[model samples]
Target: MHPARRSAGWMQTRFFVMKKKLLSLILTGLGILVLPNAALGAEPKTIGELVTKISNALYSAMSGIVLIAWIVIAFLYLTAWGSPEKLKTAHHAVIWAAVGTAILVLYKSIEPIIKNALGV
Candidate 1:
């Protein structure tokens, strides 16, 4: 065999091996990321349980965000220090925040009724 041909063949083989290893690593990482803790031997949740857990998490997160925003609005008002522009900006923020909170409440209130109507 010619030396140049032998080297080319070796390089091709190495590239194939590296490609396979890279694909394997990606699939393994994806498996770890996607699998739930329960799939690893803990108790698995039912569909309803999963839905409830996800909903609760979303509700809690939204409530916490609204509370934090209100606190921020309060600080903005306190530090306005007689500036009309700052107070006006804070007032606009409060109005938007209240609207967001109302939407969140409306969703929570309607979700259960919708679920019941749909028999889910």
Candidate 2:
């Protein structure tokens, strides 16, 4: 492989891994923050409990989605590097999708906080 292309590939892999780690960390933190303390008060079979269970499941799924996105983005980036236009498009899509995923995860993680904040 050409030296320049090799270096770009290495950089892309490293960058994608770093981004994935950072995103995961942030999501974990949000998970910690938004989880309710209902264990101290609410019953296990109550609606609150059911909602919490659903939220936990959604979080798990989003976590998987983020992991898959990282893999797909990494592949797209590595292949598209040879073509500036394609690489640009792939990078843009990856970043935007990641951002949207973050927002959705954040919302799901902190839905209670949101409701309280808005007095809903």
Candidate 3:
């Protein structure tokens, strides 16, 4: 019946609601990304085709992850405001995201070489 206890309970309830919403949003995003590919794509007949399909799926997933990472980094930077430690953490996130993006680009650039090696 105390005001402090009521406020605490309200905060906990709000936290749970936010967590559930975030989880559902993530699941929906994943379904949107994965379901179409799984349901619409034709079955691969050759080893090369199978490898290519798997590689493409991985590339798509990684690209989505990188996009989400960048969004998180931006949120970190915004929330950091003028705090030195938070800003440092945000900078680190930015660096890591950049590294991930570079890796993705490198993988994409080498796709032709991979196909050639597989003689696809």
Instruction: Point to the candidate with the largest lDDT.
Output: 3
Question: Scored by CA lDDT, what does every candidate get?
Answer: 0.69, 0.69, 0.80
lDDT of 1 by residue, 1-120 (tens): 999999878976886686578557755654554344334443326655555555655665666567657766876786676899999999999998999799788867766775576577
lDDT (Cα, tens digit) per residue for candidate 3, span 12-104 = 688668767866786578667766567758999987778777777878788778877886787678667599999999999999999999999
Candidate 3 minimal-lDDT segment of 10 residues: 31-40
Candidate 3 residue pairs in clash (backbone atoms < 3 Å): none
Greater lDDT among 1 and 3 belongs to 3
**Per-residue lDDT value at 65 in model 1:** 63
Please count the clashing residue pairs in each candidate, in the order shown: 0, 0, 0
Model 3 regions lying over 4 Å from their true place: 1-20
**113, model 2: CA deviation in Å?**
3.0
Rate residue 58 of model 2 by lDDT.
64
| Highest TM-score against the true fold, candidate | 3
Q: Looking at model 1, how many pairs of residues clash? A: 0
